[model samples]
Target: MLIRSIRLAGFRNYTEAEIHPSDGVTVFTGNNAQGKTNILEAVYLCCTGRSHRTTHDKELIKNDHDFARVTVEADRADGMHDVEILLSRISRRRIKVAGNTVSKSGEMLGHITGVLFSPEDLRMVKDGPAERRRFVDMELSQLRPAYYYALQRYNRALKQRGALLRELINAPAASDTLDMWDAELAQSGQAIMTMRRDFIAKLSEQAGKTHEFVANGAEKMEVEYVPSVRAEESGEELRTRLEKELHRARQTDIRRQITSVGPHRDDVKILLNGLDARSFGSQGQVRTCALSMKLSELEIMKKESGEAPVLMLDDVMSELDPGRRRLLIRMLSGVQTLVTCTDIEDLAGADAGKIIRVHQATLQEA
Candidate 1:
């Protein structure tokens, strides 16, 4: 898939702007806080119907503005398509694809696939379990609509279960109240767990090869899905196990006023050369692993969707060393990429397909 062009209105610092990017590599050069990242964020929002930077849509709109708009013109294998997003402060955002209104946001996934790498992504390795879980969830959501649906159901059930747990603590209730949500939570959570395990297994295989290449075959990397309940089990087995676990943890959950056992408590463990990356890997190793995981996403998305996802590098080159930068540039072959940098000279000698300058929320071809 290729992003032909994008237009933004009242998004972040930009009042109005349009950019026509090349199909190969487009570079956005600007100083700090000059609306460079905002361009990439807009494209990402158009693709996934969610922002990678923030969950609140209100923050995407400009100050004192009622709404923000982003329109993306993309070319897929089938044909060209348009995706538009409207964000309002007072109401829910609206999403449209090919001029057709979409009531469910989940229906918009995979319309325009993309893989984004930024400085903040390093947290996938060093941060807590929630960050790693989000990494898997976001990528899987884009590739598999069923996964998105199951995830949505699981989250909703988990929330309702937790609320009931809190209520039970305040006023004692019959076990039937908890039993109803347990069955619902386990049914959806089982599907989520099964899909996540399969995805992690495949992701590990891909990321392992990427890590070996990026690390010059000096380190072997592996990704492990750590479920709070069970592993290597069928959906039925998982549901049975979750049912029992939830039953056993009932007293504890009621005391804590939270659902303590489910996919929400799952995690992804990254290991480098047989050691935990989060605990033992150096800064360079951690960054390389993170990059490998992201590049693997590009490959996985292509394999699943039969179209290579657009790659967006949000000023991550500035955070990498010369060797890592070369490794990254080498992997960009045959893929459309969008990169942001502070100075044009910083990307000197790199295969910058098309270079544009962003100044004060305005864009100019260079």
Candidate 2:
């Protein structure tokens, strides 16, 4: 899938902007604070129905403006699709695909898959588990709608269970109330865990292979799924094990006033030669591994959807070495990629003819 064009009104720093993006290597070049990243963020929002930078929808609107609008034209397997998003101050945001309002956000996944790489992503390896979990969750949500539904259900159940736990803590006599919530939580949590395990397994296989190539065959990397509950089985047997573990942790959970074991506490562990990469790997190693994982995710999405996702590189080429940058460009040969940089000179040896310069959110054809 690729974005053909985009129109923005009252968004961030852009008042009224209409951009026709090229499918092959459209470059956004501008100095800092010139709305270079904002354009890419608009495209990212169109793909996921959420912003990569902030959670507040109102912040996306320009100051003193009550609403913001984004219209995206993308080419998918079905045909060219027009996605429209309306952000208002007092009402919930609106999303429409080809003039049809999308009541449920889950229905929007997989239509237009996107991969965003930024300087913030390089810290995903050293950051908290939430960051890594987000990495896995974001891709899985786009690849599998079932996983997205499960995640929504799991999050709701967790909140309800936590509330019950708090209630039980206030009145220990209501201990019986926790049983029902526990059962519900276990059912959904177990399903999420099973799906996550399967997902990480596939992801690790592809990421490891890619990492080896990116490392110049000098380093071997392994991705492992670290679940909070340990069991040596699969399928129903695994579910049974999880149930029993949850039951066993009941007392400890009550003492702590929090649910302690589930996918919420799980992690994706990166290992290089049997050592934890998150703690011991060099900064370069960590960044390379993250990049490898993202590229592998793109390949997986293509295999599942039969179309390459629109690739967005937001000032990330500046962070990579010349060899790695070349490798990334070569890998995206068949896909449409939009890259953001401070200057076209940064692309130095790469194809300069395709560069689209940006000056204060306006594109200048090369």
Candidate 3:
């Protein structure tokens, strides 16, 4: 898949702009605060039906504007698709796919899938489990719509169960509701854990190879899905496991007013040469492992989707080392990529199809 073009209105600093990108790599170069990254943000909003930078819809709208709009024209193996996201300050965001309005953002999946590597991604290794979980959830949500809905159900059940647990501290009559929420959480959490297990197994394989290549075979990397509770593959068995674990943690949940067990508490462990990268690996090792995992998604997503997903590197070139940058350039073989940087020299040897300069939120071809 490729992003043929993107149009933005009242988005960030860009009052109005559009660009048709080349099939291969497209580089956006400019100084800081020039709206280079805003362009990539627009393309990514189409891919995932949300922004990577912020959660507030109003933040995307420019000053004195009540709404912001982003439209993406993408090419896939099947056909071309147009996705539009309209953000309003007073209401929820709306999405349209192929000229048809979609009630849920999850419905916009598969039309335009992408993998993004921002400067913040470098902290994936050392940051808390929340960031790692977001990475897994976003990717899986795009590839498997079923997983997306299941995750939604799981999150709702989790919230309800937590509320019930907190209420039990003062009013114990609501204890019966805990049983119902546990069943719901287990049913959905089981599905999430099963899919996450298989995904991590595949990811570990690809990341191992990529890490070897990126690290010059000096370090071995392994990615593991560490669920809060032991998980089983069979439906009945896994459901039972989740329910039992939830029951076991009910007292702790009530005391803390938090649902402490399930996929929500799970983590992705990155091991470098047999040591946990988060706790033991050096900074270089942590960054390399993170790089391997991100780059490995290119092949994994294609394998799952049957086509390459567009790549967006938002000012990550400046954060990555020369070797990692070179590895990234070599990996952009047939995939369409949008890279933003302050200077072109960051990607000195990259074969860019379009080199555009950004100034005052406008684009100019160089």
Maximum-lDDT candidate? 1
User: Which parts of model 1 are misplaced by more than 4 Å?
Assistant: none
Better of 1 and 2 by TM-score: 1
TM for candidate 3 is 0.97
Q: Compared with the true structure, what per-residue lDDT tens digits does model 3 show for residues 257-325?
A: 999899999999999888889999887777777778877887799987789998888887777689877
The worst-scoring run of ten residues by lDDT in candidate 1 lies at: 344-353
lDDT of 1 by residue, 1-366 (tens): 888989999999999999888888899998899999999999988877778899999899999789999999889999988889999999888988898889888877888888998888889999999999999889988888888898888888788888888788878766697898899888888888998999999999999999888887888999999999876786788899889899999999899888888988999999998789999989888888998999998999989888899999898777777777777788888899999999776676578778898999989898
Clashing pairs in 1: none
Worst 10 residues of 2 by lDDT: 348-357
Q: Write the per-residue lDDT of candidate 2 for residues 1-366, one digit (tens) a residue.
A: 878788999999888888776777788887888888888889888877778898999999988789999988888879988878899998999988888999988877776678888777766677877888888888888888887887888788778878877776667787566666666666777777777788788878888888877777768887888888873455677767766777788778877978898778888887887788889989888888888878888888888789999888888778778887777777777778888898666676666326666777666776
- In candidate 2, how many clashes are counted? 0
Each model's backbone clash number = 0, 0, 0
Arranged by lDDT with the best first, the candidates are: 1, 3, 2
